[model samples]
Target chain A: MRITLIGSGNVATHLGAAFKNAGHQIVQVYSPNLQNAALLAYHIKAEAIDDLQQINPNTEAFIISVKDDVIEGIAQQLAAHDKLILHTSGSTDISVLLKYNVKAGVFYPLQTFSRTKELNFWNVPLCLEGANENIFKIITELAQTVSNNVYPVNSAQRRVLHLAAVFACNFPNYLYSIAQGLLADNHLEFDMLKPLILETADKVQQQLPAAVQTGPAVRNDETTMNRHLEMLQNQPMLQQIYQLLSQGIIKMDKGTNGKA
Target chain B: MRITLIGSGNVATHLGAAFKNAGHQIVQVYSPNLQNAALLAYHIKAEAIDDLQQINPNTEAFIISVKDDVIEGIAQQLAAHDKLILHTSGSTDISVLLKYNVKAGVFYPLQTFSRTKELNFWNVPLCLEGANENIFKIITELAQTVSNNVYPVNSAQRRVLHLAAVFACNFPNYLYSIAQGLLADNHLEFDMLKPLILETADKVQQQLPAAVQTGPAVRNDETTMNRHLEMLQNQPMLQQIYQLLSQGIIKMDKGTNGKA
Candidate 1:
């Protein structure tokens, strides 16, 4: 299959390589920035194009891996092409591309991509959606070349997955930022918490998170909770986060909803 | 050094094994539950005692590795002895032992311990606090034999470290629980987020958490945020958490105060 990538950022860089590695021909790389386009194109042995008009009409598919807001505009620019068009966004609806293109779909790769780090593409899960049965089969084959786990999810389910990811990835990283702040303020090394962080993440694999949860709030140890709250008097936001998250955990333990 | 453990819980079990591995003698294992005491004692070749009266008076140090509330009571019960007394608690102050004995100190290991997991004791940070210089030196030597990182953290500093740990470890685990719930509700596998979770944690090592922060909140992408809020309408508690944490991240990015 021949594919053209419309962006050259982190997602584009990694996806371009994965597609190329899986024996697919990357026909072209398109980006407004010539340098970024050339950088990604050069690695994949594809031509770099800075103009939207230069997109190959003969290409099998066009993957718009740009920012969420820019995706709809790019789809409009390439509306005349009869090729299958897709965007790699978790939150954006698939219908955003329907008015602009005849055949549109989503190819959201559910993993964090950083230019500096090497990711095992096989382990990354690919969440996909398509406009029709024919396009869905094509997208599934393309996705399976790079990832072993391919999930067919609708816009609503994909939106929920993205929201859950923010909690799993973004919010926890924010808490780490707060932890780093606390340690640096007290002249302690950040590495001190590395083992604890690893262990905490590992525990969730075998058991439910709520079942394996442990801490002052989980135990309802008021003395320690009060001391932590008092210590965070200067930082009102962290204090509030501590109080709310603790309450959430306690509630989750009591609630019989999911496995938690 | 010859030591006697006053509890046979997670911390005591690990610490006792680490001490024995480091060529120190564990004189006895004491616990209210004789079964637990005998199990730990059997592994370390030590006597199991259910009564405080059976404590070995001549032991060099008594490590009261019990709950925060029980440390004071145990210290009081062993006050007649002249040996050094220590407690493995992060929130409890070093002064808890001062009212009872001649020498008192703290040996709080700054890592989450599980009875089922094998920990690399060498990497665990040992935060030591003592009542006097002599006692501090004795505890530091005992701590160094097992762990490579040992620090002299006062009670106030220790309390703050423990608080930071909750943010780094416990809070992140709670967010993971939320992530798990969202995925399970949508009929997605939790394993889908493991790679993202690992990368999020690994980013903090090379860069500060604030510097590497990503996602909709940091970008202030209102469209995605609004969509996520709508998806979470049924879960009011998760909705509140999402709003608060997203607001906190946005505020941290705006504030010039901490390293964040």
Candidate 2:
């Protein structure tokens, strides 16, 4: 498939490279910033375009991999291309694709893309949706070229998946940052917690995490909880996070429907 | 070095087996529960003891690999022997070793250990603390035999490390459970997020996490946030979590203090 990648950020840079590696030709790379576009275009043997109007008429698919908020504007700009136009987003509506005259769909790769880290795109779940059956099939084929896990998730389901990803990835990192802050404030190494983090993740593959939950909160070890709280006296927001998350853990253990 | 394992729970079971693999003679395994002691002892080709009185007097070190609350009680029980006793804990005070007249120390492996998973002991961080230089040397040597990352973390530092571990491991898993719940409620497979979770963890190893945080929260996209709140209307706690965490990310990105 001849692809035109719009947006040269982490997702575009990595996915474009993967698509190119999979023998797909990236005909053009589009970014408002020429440097960002050129960075990815250079890797994929594609021409760089700073304007959506410059998107060649021949590319099989135009992937709008820009920020979610700017996606509508880009889609409007690319509405002329009657080629398949897809946006790589988990949270936004698939209807945003309809604003463009092209065969529209979503190509949300369910993975955290970092420019520094080369990722295994094969494992990423590509949640795809399209306006028509033929378009869906095409996008699904494009997604399968890069990933083994392809799901025909509609906008609503993809939105839920995006929300869940936040809980799993973003929020967890925030908690890790807080942990780092707590350790750093006390003059400690962040590396000490790496083992624990990996084990926690590996456990999910083996067992239900709720059943295996441990700590002062799950054990209801008030003494340890009190000590931990006392230690958090310096940071009120962290204290709230610790208290709320602990309560949430306790609630989850009891099979209570708690906050997400 | 000859060693005795003084407990038969997750930590002790894994550690004893690893040491046995490292060609150390686990002279004896001690536990109040006869069956538990016997089970571990058999795995390590060592004798099982039902009481503290049976702790072999000749063992170079007895790792009190028990629960945090039990370390002091076990130390009191071992007041008879001066043999080097160390508790495998991150949070417990190193001073607990002082209760026994003999040499004492800490041999805390800074990793989450479960009897089920096969772990490479060489990757585990063994945090050591001892009453004297010779004891420290012996414990450090023993630690190096099993692990690449070993350091003499003080009691205060260990306490902070353990707290940090809760954040990195326990809290992250709790957040993962929350993700699982959210997905399950929507009849989605939690497995779909595995790549994202692994990638998120992989990011911190090489770069700062905040530099790559991408989500509706960080983007400050109120449209997605509002839709998410609606989707989570049935889950009030998750709704609050989504709101608070999104707000926190926005604050963090805005270069403002992430206060309540």
Candidate 3:
């Protein structure tokens, strides 16, 4: 497939290289900033363009990988083209693209992308949705070239996935930052918590998080919990988080038991 | 070293096997329940005793791996012995043992233990604190035999580590459960979130979490956050958590900038 990538962000940079590696021709890379477009295009062996009018008409598909707020504006500019248009967003609805282009679909990858880090694109779960079966097949085929895990997810389900990703990925990373802060305050190295964090993640790979849950909250050990609360009294935000998450764990356990 | 385990729970079971593998002698496994003690003792080739009075006198060390609240009570019973006594707890102070036994220390492994899961105990960080240098050396030697990562941490630092572990390990796990529940409610498999979760954890191994923080909150994309909050309107607890954690990430980012 001849692809034109819109936006030169982390997602675009990664997907551009991946598509090129998979033998797909990246015809052009477009960004409002010409320098950013040129840098990504240089790596992917594609032409760099700053203006939307300069997007290659010969391309079979256009992937809008910009921020959520700008996705609609980018899609509107490419509405005149008859080629398939896909946005690599987890939250934005497919209808946003449908409003402009008849050959609209979504090519959402369910993984966090970092410009500084290299990703094994093959393992990324590409959640693809199309305006029609033909477009869906095209996107799925294109997705399968770069990734092994591909699913047909609608906009509603994708929204739910985006929200869940925040809980599972984003929120946890914040908690880890909090832990790092707490360790730094006590003159301790963050390395001490790495093994435990890795093990907690590994547990979920084989078992449900609820079943594998450990610590004071799950044990209902109020003494330890109180000590922790008192220790965090100076940081009221952390104290509130500690209390709420503990309660959430207990409540979930009780709900599971009731169901059982 | 001939050691007697004072609890037959997950910690005692894993440590008992690890100690045996490290070529130390486990003299006895004790629990209030004889069956539990016998089960662990059988595996480690040790005697099983339910009564605290039946504890072997020939043991070189007594490792009390019981609940935090009962550590003092268990220490009180074994106070008459002049040999080393260690409690495997992250929160409890060494003073609890110092008040009883002369040779007192702490042997804390900073890892989540499960009865069904086999741990690579060699990688677990063993945090030790002794009443004196001599006692510290003894406990350190014992810890080194089982784990490669051992640290001589004081009581206050150990308490902080425990609190940090809750944030880094337990709280993140609860967030994972919440994600799992959200996916289930939306007819999505939890497996979809696994790659993202693993990557989130993997990022922290080499980078500071605050530096790698991603998502709507860190991006300050209030549009998506409001959408998520609306989606989670039914679950008030989850809604509150979403708000608090997002605020936390934003605040931390601001603090990091202010410092810079």
Give the per-residue lDDT of model 2 (tens digit) for A164-190. Answer: 998899887777676766676777777
For each candidate, what is the lDDT?
0.87, 0.81, 0.90
Candidate 1 per-residue C-alpha lDDT over B20-129 given as tens digits, one digit per residue, 9 for 90 to 100: 99999999999999999999999999999999999888699999999899999999988888888899999998888898755899999998877877879998889999
Model 1 bad stretches (over 4 Å):
A254-260, B254-260
DockQ of each: 0.63, 0.54, 0.64
What are the TM-scores, per candidate, against the unseen true structure?
0.93, 0.95, 0.96
DockQ computed for model 2 against the true two-chain complex using alpha carbons: 0.54
Over A167-225, each residue of candidate 3 has an lDDT whose tens digit, in order, gives 99999989888888888887888889998888888888878888888899988889899
For residue B192, give model 3's deviation from the true position in Å: 0.6
Preferred candidate (DockQ higher): 2 or 3? 3
DockQ computed for model 3 against the true two-chain complex using alpha carbons:
0.64
- The top-ranked prediction according to DockQ is 3
Q: Taking the candidates one at a time, how many backbone clashes does each contain?
A: 0, 4, 0
> Which candidate ranks first by lDDT, i.e. highest?
3
All candidates: CA RMSD (Å): 2.3, 2.5, 2.0
